[model samples]
Target: MSLELESASVEQTQEIAQQIARLVEPGDVILLNGDLGAGKTHFTQGLAAGLETPTVPTSPTFNIMFVYEGGRLPLYHFDLYRLEDADELEDIDYYGTIEGDGVSVVEWADKFEDAQPDECLAITIRILPDQTRVLSLEPYGGHFEDIVAAIA
Candidate 1:
């Protein structure tokens, strides 16, 4: 399933994220695709809010990943933007992370498509000339089809 949503402001973008977060389950993988300054981190912050995480969310660009607890489920946030290849994924135990008892959101996931699970939710954010954002959600398998349908 596929969906297209428009967010005219940062708050709207985050609100949309929260709506999706409400439906997340453990072991779910969310792939975020967009260029720099596309509000990926902001969306993540919204997810954290919906998950009831106490810690504030931040971009994992330099650290590669960050773990947030104190929520309904833990959040394993990953930023693969700086990685050279999927080989680096092993260093971070990428597969293991996503398989854990929490939800995983990967930024710059387009870089390592092969490493992504077949049943993940992929969100692509496009910036328009008016500074609005167009978020396109694509579900790779039946697991995410319901989510896309509900959020759409």
Candidate 2:
């Protein structure tokens, strides 16, 4: 599908994420990009909240990956900031999480190029002045396209 972009505040960003989450099924991957403090985690919080797992979802930076299971589908939150290489994924079961029965939201996904799964939603958030954001969503596959369309 064509890439979808929008301007949003932190709350609007979360609401958009929630709307998108309504269409996601299990085993979905999200590839996110933005500079520091681009509201990536805020979008994830909206996604988890939309999934009915309304809670404070952390960065998972130190933990590498945080799995939240109290939603309609499980949520696998991965932060790759401290990750040196994608090769270390095997040690932490990256493939397992991406191919498993859950929704995975990955922050700083630029570190993994060819390693990213085929079925993934790519997002880029640009921080604007005055606490606003420019967010773009590029769905990479048919499944993700459908989800994007639904949310759009």
Candidate 3:
């Protein structure tokens, strides 16, 4: 199943992220696709809130990945925008991170679709001319379908 939502402000986007976060579990992967300044990181911050993590999530562009513990489940935030190829994912141990006991959120995930697992939640954020953001959630497996249903 899929879901399309509109966010009039950053807070709304975060709210949507939090809603989704509640449905997240270990071994789950969230693929985020959006342009620069599309609020991917903001959405992540909300995920951290839903997970109840002590540390807020920030853009992992420079660091590649940031692990947040002490939440309902750990959050492995990854940004692949700076990477030129999916092969670089290995350097960061991408597979290991996602397969571990945490929920992985990958920004610029469209850039490395081939590297993504078959079952995952794919979210695309599009910025409208009026500045509102449109978030489209596409679920690739049954687990994700349930998440979408709950969000709906």
Tell me the tens digit of each residue's lDDT in model 2 across 1-152: 75655655778989989988898888899988999899999999999999998566888989999989888999999998898977888888988888889999999988888778877899999986776787888888899889888877
- List candidate 1 segments past 4 Å from native: none
| Superposition TM-score, candidate 3 onto the true structure | 0.98
Worst lDDT run of 10 residues, candidate 3, spans: 108-117
Candidate 3 regions exceeding 4 Å error are: none
Candidate 3, residues 6-122: lDDT per residue as tens digits? 999989999999998889999999999999999999999999999999998889999999999999999999999999987898899999999999999999998877898999999
Global lDDT of each model? 0.94, 0.86, 0.93
Model 1 poorest ten-residue lDDT run: 140-149
Best to worst by lDDT, what's the order? Answer: 1, 3, 2
Clash count for candidate 2 is 1
RMSD of each: 0.7, 1.3, 0.7
7-114 in candidate 1: lDDT tens per residue? 999899889989988999999999999999998999999999999999989999999999999999999999999999888999999999999899999999999888
